[model samples]
Target: MRVRVLRVLDVGGLPRVFWWVWVSTLVARTGAFVAPFLSYYLTRSLGHSAAFAGFVAALNAGGAAVSAVVGGVLADRVGRRGTLLGALVASAVTLVALGSVHSVGLIAVLAFLAGLANNATRPATGAIIADIVPSGDRGRAYALNYWAINLGFAVAMLSAGAVASHGYSLLFMGDAIANVGCAVVVFFTVPETRPTSVGVAGAGHAGQPERAGTLVDVLRDRIFLGFLGAVLVGAVIYSQAQTVQPIMMGQDGLGPGAYGAVAALNGILIGVLQLPMTSWMRRYTHGSVLAASSFLMGAGFAVPLLISAVGHPMGVYAGSVVVWTIAEIGSTPPQMALGADLAPAHLRGRYQGMSTLAWSVAGIVGPLVGGWALTAIGASAVLWASLLLGAAGVPAWVMLDRRSRTRVATLRAAEAHWEPVLSAIASPEVVSAGVPTSEPEPEPV
Candidate 1:
């Protein structure tokens, strides 16, 4: 089915924002390509074992999880552009620092800091896109951004392997350079999005000051929490690609080059196919889309279990890549879009941040479980764990789907019931943190 090109620039002057988002996604992902190889470098070059590598990687993921939430809050309070700029610069510095470290302990600490900085920009980026793009066009914008990110990742992963063949140090240095270069571009090009009264920051004024919303206010919304729960389930499975797959494959005789190739394949599918997939999926209910995609993703993860030894290991690993890519095409963008959808008009950053936080936690924890499974049981168990998590997502996804639909229904009833109340709250505009003061009190006759 052919989809019309929905433009994201109804408000005007947003082309530059889109360009910056595209470039930033590319550059950030290029730097991110080095992440998958970190464990390999530590274990193979520095002589650490898989378990030790898992611990180190876990620390980085843990840091990223913490920073993601903090980044969201700061972006809502400060501005998206500034928050993104800071995160990009910090990540670049940390990646460079990571290259300089030789001690195992030091590397772990640096890795955590790097992950934190790397992930912190997520909410800010999402918020910026929400701020600039019209709602109708936001999905396409996000899909395109997702494509740029995956494209860069694919290139980076392939390049990392080739560069690492020369020297692992070279890969790290290259990633840092790309990160810094991207940061510079973002600092100049990405406009700051301020919070608006409705919860969207910088909706009208780019530099206008907005009061931040209380965490309590953001959390109390049942719809937002429901969306966050769904995201967390998906994130747990997604992190396996970065932290678990390499270790599992290594045990089965697949080397970094092969693993990187798999990553490259995953990237290609996402970059090339995600928009098309999202376009088709957008017509469906978001809940159904998420549930179907989650199952596919889980199926992809399970397929890798068949391969044991190197040299393709029964060809299942290669096949699994295709399956996983298909699942990713179904899963990732919709998840981002859903999070954006659930956030109140003004509070995209907080909600996006919370989603990132869930991902961060999953990133930290998934590998720990996979690592233990690999150490204690075998690679097969890792697949089992992924499958279980994927299966577990079904009930929550159903709950969220029901809840989301109901919220839309209830919004109408609430609007009618509290029409007067809402008016009073909006009168005089009690602005805090750039967000609108609160819901209005019913108006007096």
Candidate 2:
């Protein structure tokens, strides 16, 4: 058992920079008290309606979406280190300011700004990992990062209730302090990792002209766009655990404590099993793992239908949580790694930012849709809808995998087609004839 644990935790051969990033992430997430309890703070502490609370949350999500794009551009242009440092500092300030506001309108505005600052760091962080870690080690690196996030989140959730009982101000202040600490770590340890123009040119597709790294380039990538759509759907389905699941459970007579326990189970399961699962999943393709993840997530939510029918709703709900937690564990690392893998060196930050944008959009859309579905269709329909959405991702990923393989094959063929010409140009005889003698560059694999 000890040996197994050691093997699971052994993310060897990664750079020292990656470990510091992991550490900073863990610290930041551990102090992320506001997001988990945002709704409660609004509805209970701030004397707002549930609808108003939802609106504020949506505003925050919108801010995050917008900032993700901006952050990506900044990371690419200004450098990853600077973008991350600015984001952390800005987030810390906003969080502290948020702790003092009284007016609802002001609070909403502050929440948006806070979210913008908080989420702006994501793309830079992801880009740095992709920049430093080799492709083969990326899955483990991302998995370890995920593990750190869950571990921190578990600690946050466990402590949040106790802290909130005193005053919500403490929660915001704690989060602010943590964000500042994260910034300090980045300032002292993390370095700028954005690739230079020459490096970008060398790492791009061979035989294709170098293009500027921009949103236009990302939007033109059909395979990545499809993957992003699928990510949106999956994010919506996953979002229900926070938005709809607890409400439905409450209506079914489960107490808030029960919901809290179930949510805690999610964090604990991910924290415990993610590393081992990542190790095991290394044998599978990203598509296969994602496909299984989608199915499990759908099935987990759908299982409640059967269990509720049999009058054992709580038991079934717990079981469903287990299933979906496993799915989350399986899907997240590979999905993150795939984004890094698919991106060119120059556009890595933007690609990761686009992925973050998908989740942010889902954050806005999921609750609104889930709430309407619950009101218009009923709980069962909502579950079925979640199931369908999860199932839909399976085909999207399969298609993405197909398209990616086709692109790689095409690139390889292009390389083959260009090789002889390049060789001939590089030959001494050709050089003597005044032709250039540069070696052929291989396209990014």
Candidate 3:
């Protein structure tokens, strides 16, 4: 039993730098107390309406959307390490400042800035994972990193209520400290993953030199854009738990502690079940897994409608959380892998940034609409809408899957285009970091 557990948890074969990145992600996510609770803080602490809270949360996500473009461009132009480090430091400063202020205008402005600074690190982080982990294990590597994120979230959720009870100052301060920890890890341990010489990093077919991509170039990709559209749909469904769940629970007479417990359940279930679920899901194609996840998430979000009939709020909420967490696990790894599979190495940062942008856009839309619906229309209405929205994406995913076989092959070849570049440029300071760089080598059968 112990051996089985070890086998499931072990990550010894990946590059050492990946561990540093994992550590940074773990430390950072463990302190993700602010964003999740921001809506609660607005309603309960600051005496704002749920609609206003949604607006602010949407505004924050808007900042993330803008940063997605800038951060991706910077990651490619400037370098991943520097962009990540600068973003983290800025995030820490912005988080602290946002926590210190009291004015409504200041809160909105700072929330936007905080979103920009905090989320700008994502493209760099995803690009780094793409850079270091071998091709065959990329899916599993992403799953492992996601596990670390959920594990940390579970830890944070466990203490968020207790800490918030002490004061939200402590919550923001703790979150800032965690950002600093992430920066320290990155500055010392995680090396630059983007190739210094553009020619060495992303040489193309027939000895042709590849050019740097513009946002236009990335947008020109119709298939990828369609995939992003699909991503936007799922992200909207996921964001409801953040934006509307608190308000729903609050109206139902559940406090922050109850919400925290419910949120914590999501993290715990994901931390425990993500890997095994991801492992089991390997047999399925990405389209099918994502399609099923969509339905599950829709069902999970709609479960809150059963509140009055169920009579046990926490039990119903916990059950809902379990369903949603499973949906999250099913969707995340494949989504990450497919995103990686679709982009060229040269535009990885931009591609990841665009992926993040989809989520950010969803963040803006989900809360803006969900919060309004919760306050104006009804919570049941908002949730039911999410189910329909999720269902709309199934055909899109299925169509994309049918078209993706050729694109994936092209992508694999593109990545292989970087192998000689990676081998030639490898060093302690440069990219690749000793992990196998290409997807051509078949995994052991």
lDDT of 3: 0.80
Score each candidate by Cα lDDT: 0.69, 0.80, 0.80
- List clash counts for every candidate, in order: 25, 0, 0
Can you write out model 1's per-residue Cα lDDT over 1-445, one digit (the tens) per residue? 1222432212222344576678878876776656778888888998989988878877887888888778887777666666788888888788888878998778888988988888888998887776555444566677778788778877776677678889888877888788778877775565445434333222223334433355676679877787777777777787788767777778677787888677667766676677667667667766787787777777778887655454456367778778777777766666776677666545667878888888777766666666677788877777887787777777777778787765544433422333233233223332112232333211111
RMSD for all candidates, in order, please.
7.8, 8.2, 5.6
Candidates 1 and 3 compared: the better one by TM-score is 3
Superposed Cα RMSD, model 2: 8.2
Q: Can you write out model 3's per-residue Cα lDDT over 171-230, one digit (the tens) per residue? A: 889999999999988877776667433344354463665456667778999989989998
- Model 2's TM-score against the true structure: 0.88
**How well is each residue in 1-445 modelled by candidate 2, as lDDT tens digits?**
8766567666665676788889999999989999878888888887889989878887888889999888887777766777899999999999998889988889899989988999999999998887767666788899999899889888888888898889999999999999999988777666555654223342344546654557888899988898888788888888889878888889888998899789888988887788778888988888888888987888777777885568876787898899999989888888898888778666777888999999999888888899899999999999898788788888888878777776544534433433343333323343233211222222231
Model 2 misplaced regions, further than 4 Å: 1-5, 197-211, 406-445
Least well predicted 10-residue stretch by lDDT in candidate 1: 436-445
Residue 195 error, candidate 2, Å: 0.9
